[model samples]
Target: MNEEPRLSAQDMIERLEPALSPMTRIRAVAALLAGLAGAVFVGTLWWSEPGPLPGRTQLAFAVFTVFCLAWAGYGGWLLTRRAALFATDRVIAAWIGLVASLTTTGIVTAVAVRRGTGTGPALAVGGLFVAVALVLTVRAHARRAALLRRVRELTGPEE
Candidate 1:
C-alpha cells in the first residue's frame, strides 16, 4: 500500500497559521460559554440553597468558580494570540494543564455529591464539563504528537 509523505513541522505550521484566525474566534466563543456556565452554576447554587451551605461545599464552589475563570482565561489567550504556534511541547503543556483542571472539577463534584446536597441537573452539567474537557485534552495531545513527529522528520538524523 502507498503512504503519503509526512510534512515538516515548519510546513505544517505555515499551513495552520492561516487557520488560526478562525480557531481564535472559536476559542473566544468557547470562553464566553464557559463563563456563562459558571454564572449558571453560581445561580443554581444560590437558588437551591434554601439554607446555608456547609463550609466545605462553600469552599468547593469557590474553587470551582476560580477553575472556571481560569478556563476562560485560557480561551482568551487562544483568542488574542494569533501568533499562537502550537509547538508540540506547548500542546503537551496544554494537555497537562487541562487534565489537572478537569481532575479538580471531578473531585470537587464527587465530594459535593457525596457530602453536600446537589440537584440532579447540576450534577449532569458538571459531568458534561468533565466529558468536554477530556475530549479536548485528547485532541490537544494528539495534535502535539503529530507536530513533534513532523518536527523530527524535518530535522532528520544529523550526519
Candidate 2:
C-alpha cells in the first residue's frame, strides 16, 4: 500500500515562496514596470525636445535612461533565474529604490520646472516610479511578515 505525502508539492512551494528570493516574480514585476516605464518616458522626453538642451543636461538624461533600461533588463532576466535575497535584504533594497526614485524625480522635475519645458511629463514619469517604489516597499514588508509567520509555524509557539 502507498502512503500519501503529508503536503502537496504545490502547497509546500506556496508556503515556502516568501523564503525564496522573497517572492521573485513579484519583485521582478515591480522592477520591470518601474524601470521600463521610467526609461521610455524619460528617453522620449529627452529626444523629442525641439529646443537645444544643455550638454550636461543631455548627458544626465542619457545616463539616467540607460540605467533605467539596465534595471529593466535585470528584472526580465530575474524572471527566468533564481537569486536568493532574504526578507531583510528585500526590505533594504526596496527602501533604497524608493529613495533613488524620489531623488531622481526631484532633480529631473526641478530641471524641467526651471526650464519651463517637459515639466508635466517629468512629473508623470516620476509619479510612476514613486508609485512602483511604494508598492515594492509594501510588498517587501508583507513578504517579511509571511516569512516570519512561516518560521513560527514550522518551529511552533514560544515556550
Candidate 3:
C-alpha cells in the first residue's frame, strides 16, 4: 500500500493561501491605509502649529503620537498573520485600549500640572476616554477567553 507523505510547514501554508477570504485581504489593506492616514494627520497637525510647543508638552505629544502610530501599524500587521481570527481581533482591541489609556493619562497629567479653568474640561474629556478604554479592554479579554476555549476544543485534551 502507498501512503502520502506529511505536508511540510511551507506546503501547508501554500495550501491554505487560497482558502483565505478576499474580505481578509481587504481588511488588512484598509487597516494599513488607516494607519498611514492617522500618522500623516497627526504629523500635519503638529507641523502646522504656529509656534513651538514647550519641552514637556512636546515630549508628551511625541509620546502620544508614537504610541498611536505603533499600535495602528501593529494592528494592521497583526491581521495579516496566520493566527486565529478571534485572537488577532483581541490583540488589536487590546492595543487600541492601551493607546487610549496612555494618551488619556498623559493628557490628564498635563492638564493637572497646568492647573487652570481649562483643566476641568480636559479632565472631563480624559475621563470619558478612560471609561471607553476600560470597556474595550474588558471586551477584548472576554473575547480572548472565549477564543482560548475554542482553541482548546479544536486541539483536544493535552497531557
lDDT of 3: 0.67
lDDT tens digits, residue span 1-159, model 3:
899997654455456663335676566666666767777777777778788887876776676677657656765675656633554565565667667676767677676867754666666777777877777777878888887787577655754
Off by over 4 Å in 2: 1-86
Model 1, 76-152: lDDT tens digits are 66655544365533464356456655666676567767766764655577667767767777777788778767767
Estimate every model's Cα lDDT from 0 to 1. Answer: 0.64, 0.77, 0.67
lDDT of 1: 0.64
By lDDT, the best candidate is 2
Task: Write model 2 residue lDDT over 1-159, tens digit each, in one string.
Answer: 999867743355566663435466787777778889999999999989999999868977887887687668757766655433436656766776787788789888988978889788998999999999999999999999897777667756554
Clashing pairs for model 2 are: none
User: How many angstroms is residue 108 displaced in model 2 relative to the true structure, after the best TM-score fit?
Assistant: 0.9
Find the 10 residues in a row with the least total lDDT in model 1.
Answer: 84-93
Clash numbers, per candidate: 0, 0, 0
Enumerate residue pairs that collide in model 3: none
Question: Model 2, 74: alpha-carbon shift in Å?
Answer: 16
Summed over model 1, clashes come to: 0
